[model samples]
Target: MISINDLTFLIGSRALYDEANWHIKPGDRVGLIGANGTGKSTLLKIIVGEYAPTSGTVSMSKDLKIGYLNQDLLSYDSHLPILNVAMEAFERQNQLQKEIDELLKQMETDYSDDILQKLSNKQEEFSALDGYNIEYKTNEVLAGLGFSTEDQLRPLNTFSGGWRMRVMLAKILLQDPDILLLDEPTNHMDLPSIKWLETYLQSFEGAIVIVSHDRYFLDKIVNRIVESRKGKLTSYAGNYSFYLEEKALRSEIQRGEFKNQQAKIKQEERLIERFKAKASKAKMAQSRIKALDKLERVEDVDDDNPTVNFSFKFTKTSGRHVVRLENVTKSYPNVDILDNAEATIEKGDKIALIGANGKGKSTLLRIIAGTETFKGKVETGHNVTTTFFAQHQLESLHLDNSILEELQAFAPKHSDTELRSLLGCFLFTGDDVFKKIRVLSGGEKSRVALAKSLTTDSNFLILDEPTNHLDIQSVNILIQALQQYEGTFISVSHDRYFLDSVANKIWFIEEEKIKEYPGTYAEFEVWNSKRVIPPSKSIPVVPTKKEEKKPVNTNADNKQQLKKLNQDLSKLESLIEELEKAIKEKEAEMADPEIFNNQDKLSLINNAYISDKSALEKAQQDWETLAEEIMNLEA
Candidate 1:
């Protein structure tokens, strides 16, 4: 539906994209992936005609409708309720409705058949455009995005910045434009809201071009990855994981080519040097010298790997029992914010606290971090070290201090050089390090907060919505870095992919109660699925591939086979649940004290349990095999 041909963009003297050729077909769900400052958002703006390219052309179908969601726009305000804001997408339909209403009113005075016929025709057109379902669709999207029924009637001013973004999303979805250009669409969405978006996008009719940092979302939704690097566009026919794997392979190949070119250039120079020293081989020497001069030197591309590699060396050891909240209760008149809540953060625990907005998720984080006091016990671990990063952590930084100076103040032990190096990882390069903290953008401020957090040698990290304002690549790098750190962390993040990556346990905060689920994201998904449907009906069928092995080919058959394998893998997930149940039952039987007391009974139960456990292990391994196959299919 849209095409970008030989597109070039320049910011001052620096090139953002040069001869970048790309296009979106009618139903293409392409994900624009790149590191921060790589012009993903800029490209989207160019496509939507918000900004003109320095050269080349961006063309689209004459009647193509484009819906572009910029990261941060001017806040919308009106006396109408939130629902009305969404309903604006269907303005044509609304106009038709207004005409019908007027027609009905005039029916008492003018009994003309022609007027009634026109009214009937307009009503039909409106109905065909799904005008009747406008209210229902508006409510569906709002509720899916975590807006309460009462919230639908509330004015836009009543909502926070994040909530305002949700309102924007609802309107965009309602528009159903031909091409959807989303910039960090999931930045403010909670897990459930993100899931809703995933499903919505999956079934979306028109083309989708998204620039998001959520890996899981990209992996699940996007079929293609378009990367912006070194003022060029590179396309990969797969998801985010495939892009990573292929990019690594391409990097290795480039490194090899670069080395070979350097070797050849040196070899030519050596021949020239030898010939210059001898009279007999003067002609050959001059030829070699000319060849060396004529050699077009390869411009080596710098490997832009911005991975934060920092470790916290705790100054003091914390007791086994960290911060403990016993019967902690907080209320504001009629509303019970936190009702008799109890939670604990032990040593070396990585916890993810999540809940809907206005559900006290941040309030609880504050109460635990000792930023706010509660009615009950807020016992701290013995000699415990804690560092809390609230959502507004950037605002907490000293505005007068430069980026480097701010880091130095918070992390006094680090030298100027060390502080600059740390800031560089967060993309604060050259004079950016010298910029005053107050002058930085929202994204820059977020990076500063992250840099400052790493400076502390605290064993426990308490972060609230740390992923906010960060692009997808930054979030993934942060997730990867945090996963390796040996520290107890309690983070409140709306990024589901981030939580899935780093968190080993989930602390779901709902109805003023904390529920702990001990498992990875996949396991949690299985448990959640069971809660929705009956065990018998939930059985997933695993289909075995017809062939023992398949040859590597880029033929249509290969694609079809991959699709079939993915379908089969989806079917086989139910077997995992069955095996899990058996394993649990066996463990329970082996745990019985009476069975342990009798030698014969103990042996029988132990043997049966061990056999069952082994079988379960094999099934789990097979499931992994199927999962990898599905991953390849996606790739």
Candidate 2:
């Protein structure tokens, strides 16, 4: 529950919000919608107390707890395991457990009434905080976000930026705040995760305010829409579809009013010009002029939103069969992502890869694109020029290069003017083209990647999660461009609307097998809904027999091992803390103007900072390992 009253935010000469007022009640599901630069995200930050409004007040309940999922990936200790990262959400619970453990250890030596009382109190506090169920809840949330069981134990640094964002989302969800402020929450999630999120939010007790470009997701989760435009906010009561219809009707009425107002102003101007010269009518002319001056001008209505206009051109046409795979199999140590999967893609075919996360959809696409090694017969037709866009393509960008320079590398022959025009279509205009890739937001980086992918001529396109950070208008424009493409493409996307619009064929991957269906996404959904699909039988099962236990060590021996491990863990933690503090101090020093002004000093500090961060990460990993070993010994 929150209330924003007469809020006004300004940046330089530009006004993002002018006297905007809105109220969010309990259980309200509100979707924030606007063009890319209309301050939708900025408004969310204001509500979350990250940004202060230039004028007016934002009031919330005193007991309200807000969970915010930031658009940018926050800095983290890379060496920490993801499970520990998620556990950070339960601060009080973790503290209680730590106290309980320490108290128990103290009681083992003291055997005093005071220690026993403290231990009893801590145990009661732990139970009240649901400390025992923390592991179960953490595992459930992580799995729902597409993390494998083994992945929870892996260090955070091993995952890509997108996956790291999912880790952040898991932390926020586990926090269970009274309100949720999510910005493009589904950008990094696969279809299965998105579906799970939708279901989870449906029963959420608190209010939610989300800024998303996923239309289907908005339709499924939001019960209200808030549109920001012209430094003002307007509220509509309904889902996204209902909001669209209502907005269209409002725009139509506004257009009529604007036209009528323009006509009246023109008539008055003509009358004033004609009568002002005559002495007899001068008074009347002055009256009309004053009236015109006092009247408020009507704002012109935009018929349609701005969109990108670009087309893909192929250097040469491909043969009848664009791609073919025979008995393709991709396997890891103990898991088979794809087992003898077979499929044939004809020329001009637009296929959509759909399945649960980690079910070989991307793997299949990689095999076809010749990026991954597989045990199978894979062949591309004659004259087929393939271009592949990986899911983490944005991260692969040269951060030191300007956006214009990045595109120029792909198209060396194109003049600056032509490249600038191309960048304009992707919403990078004027000085934006000169910005280094490192300063760009996730969505902006994604656009640069998409623009670069279109530079070279290719007949077969293989894209993974291409629409992850795209806005609705941009996605529509991209869909229109792909519709007119003459080449074949295979894209893996979780956007149901995008698939429905672009996909002419469906490749469903399940249980390490690919099932091909010849139809649109709607048709595929219909057939899937009608049929009673059987459970997957390919999942490997372990033997039910229990293993023979080894002889247990004596209590004294176990206690000694535990004591050594605890000492190691304590030392490692102390080292990690010192490294973190040093790194922070170095970073603060580097941020000073004098430090950056000196080239030699700046370089020295930068190197030291990097070294310190690396040491900190290693120390964190060592600390985690020692702590786990201690836990095992104590158990």
Candidate 3:
């Protein structure tokens, strides 16, 4: 569907892509992968026309439709119900409906034959556009992406960034584009949502390019692997696991060639040096020098995976019993998290907490950290010093402090040199250690927070969504760190690969109670999937076929509400744009070192950010108030 040839993209004097070529045919499921800053997301933007190649062109059919989902897409929000926002995907249908509505209003005043004819024409066009099924398609896509019927009626502005991202994805999916470009699409998804998306994409008819660090996801959804390495797109003909094997074979061959080539080159140099001084052999020496200069040297293989190179040490050891929770109960405004839930962590236990969203995985982690309120008995084992790393803690880092300084402040027990060595293992090199936390990307900040977590002499750790924004390389580094850790830890994550690599036990919450399986995530999945099957009987998944979607009818009330939405759509769009812009500005100001230093300025900036979001929330509430008349308006 798309052809990329001899593409070269430059950033300043650096080449992000150099004469890279790729062809995406129909139904190509490509997994684009590389280290952070290797331009995976940038390449997606280039395909979507948001960015242009510095040299070369991306050509495709004129009628090609592309759907792109990225972090920036989350900036879009509206006070309209998510259902209506998703309905906006039917652009031509909406226009036709509006014209038909205008014609109907005209007929109400004067039932002219001309008005009647125009109304009939518009209605015919709307039907031809499949406008009758717009609501059905939107609702189906939203539900598949893990939204409830009630959630579809709630305003887009009321959802958090992660949820709003799903709404955006629903809109994109409803568009039914010829190709989809998803960047880290699973970063915000839970296990169930990820599985749903995987199944959906497996049935998709069009091409898809996914950039994600979730290897299990890639293995499930993709048939081809494309590595963005050395400023080129190298194609692999199978899933990620296959690519690993193929790449290893290629690396071995390259290493051999590199070694032989280096030896030959050294021999040629030695011969030239010995012969150049003699007048009789001077001419031959020049010819040999020229031949050596013209030789195409082989590039040595670079290690993509970095491991633990620094000594990981803890000053104290915990007792045999790391932690004990008895009769823990916690609840929220609408959902009950725990009802006398009980679980335990023992010395050297590596547990993975996983479930669908709103299952209170993070809440449980907090209760263990002693940072959350609960009505239960939580006992900590003796000599247990703990370190907790959560996404929210990334903001707790001193914005003005350099990474080195932040680690120094947190790890007073370690000397500057020792901390520096530790940071290097986390991929923070010489100058990178001096970068202010304010300027670090999400992945970079995650690394710094993780580095700080290791700085503690604590033997017990709790990490929440530690792999959320990290690239595969960063995730690998984290895996190495976690594997090398001698203490007990409980990590909350949706990454199955990460869990399988580090977790010895799996913990999940169900029916407001904690459940445990004493095995790796892969083992747990196998057991869970077959939990209901009899031991003698086997699951017969024969002749598997996907469920077909058919057009469904919408109720009359929703039709009226959808029509009425046209009048307020533009106003809501404008308001959302302003709110998003204000939020970004306030956030940037809050990150300013000067503002961070001045307590008053920091408070004012933080307040402004909160106020901007609150205003957006108020706008959403207004939409909710309208929703009885807008969403699910049927009496």
Candidate 4:
């Protein structure tokens, strides 16, 4: 739907993109990825028309509607409730509703056919636009994005910046434009919210071009990957995994080609040098020199992509039971966040705390860390020193201090050289360490906070969303470092890939209870899938005496049950696929200028499209439930 033609953008003397050309077609889900400072966001801005490219044209269909969610937080009316803010996306629907209300009031006095006809027409328009479902859809999205019904009614100003960002995200999703330009949409979302977004986007008809550091999110949603590097755009035809494999292969090939070319050039140079001094070989030498001058040099690829490399050094070993909580109860004025919650952390357990927002995952972490009071027995084992990294810890940094100073304050015993080296691991190098904390960007400050946390010699770490602002590389570095560390940690993270790599145990919190699942994140997913539809709590079926007298056909019954389940699963899958196809067909029809111009046809197709999408989502859930049941039965 949008075409970037030979686009070039310059930031001061640095070229962000040079002669970059890309085409985004309808239903294309592209994940824009690259290292930090590689202009991914800038490219998105150019596409969204927020910033004009230095050269070339970004052309789009004149009727195409684009929704751009930038990384920066939006400034909205703080007094307005979050639900109201989200509903603002359907401004036309809101206006029509207002008009309808006024028309109803007028009808009470005039009772005229003209007024009734006007109201009827407006109501039809609203129904055609699915205006009646606006509140339902809005609430659904808000809930999926981690807003409780009560929270929805709370004023927007009551939420933190991160939560406000989520409200903005809900608004954009509600808008449902033809194209989405999302930059780090999952930055503020928790695990459940991210999963909800993944499911939502999977059925979204519009084209999606996202720039996110969350690899798991990209893998789940994006069909194509585009890397912005060195002012050049490279396209990968698959998800992040494919991109990694392909990039490694390409890099290796490039490195070999470069080496071979360098060897040939050196050989030619040597031949010319040796033969140049001889009068008999002067012509040959001159020819060789000209060839050398005309030869194109292969640029060497640098392996150094700036990675953090630090490991936690535990000051002392903790007892076998590092932390223990019993009958933990934390409450607010009228709400109980946690009641009768119990959990245990071993000496070397790497636990991932996961749950929906407001489920008290962070509160549990704080309670265990002794930062928050609870009406329960919370005990830390002997020598269990703790290093806590809160979600907002970066925001609470000493602004006046430099990055170097911040780390120094935490690790005063370390030498200046050692401190600088540690900072370098976190991507703060040389003069970057001298940069004032107040001057750093959110991501930079996050890095500094992480650096400070890593400097601590603690046996246990309580981290809440530590990967929120770190780039993909930094996250990977952290994964590697954590893999090597012997210290135990309980981290609350939404990045599935990161959790899969780092977490050895899963603490799933639901209804104030922490259920422990002993496995990696991937294994936890498999286990969770099987249990999504719990086994029946009712009594088992008992055959009557007459039935028992006959040949017991248990095997036959089992086979029949399995066959029927398989058939149902297949039917649901087929129905979902058909619905998706219908939705896509309707979307393509809506994009057609002829169909778009025809108001009656547009309304019909739009309503059908919405219905098809809704059906597809339902069918998918049914398919999943059946599939899970089948798997359980077979096992």
Which stretches of candidate 1 lie above 4 Å from their native place? 276-301, 307-310, 332-335, 532-635
lDDT of 1 by residue, 544-599 (tens): 54454556666576677777766665555666677678767756764564552334
Candidate 1, pairs of clashing residues: 213-472, 540-571, 540-574, 541-571, 541-572, 542-572
Residue 227's C-alpha lDDT in candidate 4? 89
Models 1 onward score TM values of: 0.80, 0.77, 0.81, 0.82
Give one digit per residue, the lDDT tens place, for model 2 in 219-284: 999999999887888999998999999989999889899999999999999999999999999999
Model 4 alpha-carbon drift over 4 Å, by segment: 109-117, 304-312, 395-400, 412-418, 532-635
lDDT of 4 by residue, 1-635 (tens): 88888888999988889999899999999999988888998888787778999999999888998888885655654799998989999989999888877887886798888997887788778768988568769878998898866788999999887799999989999998999889999877887788889999999999999999999899999999998888988899989998888888888898999999999999999999999999999999999999999998888877645544444555589999999999998987865687788889998899999876767888888899888988989988989999899857877799999999888888876667777877776778779999999998877888889878877888898999888778788788778768877889999988888899999899976655778999999999898765854322222121111112235647676677778878777777677778878988987887675664355687688767766765676567667766776776677
TM-score of candidate 1 against the unseen true structure: 0.80
lDDT at 584 for candidate 2?
Answer: 79
**Worst lDDT 10-window in candidate 1:** 532-541
- RMSD vs true structure, all candidates: 17.7, 16.4, 16.6, 8.3
How many Å off is the CA of 107 in candidate 3?
3.6
By how many angstroms RMSD does model 2 differ from the true structure? 16.4
Q: Pick the candidate with the highest lDDT.
A: 3
Off by over 4 Å in 3: 109-113, 412-418, 532-635
lDDT score, candidate 4, position 494: 87
* Pairs clashing within candidate 4: 308-425
Clashes of each: 6, 0, 0, 1
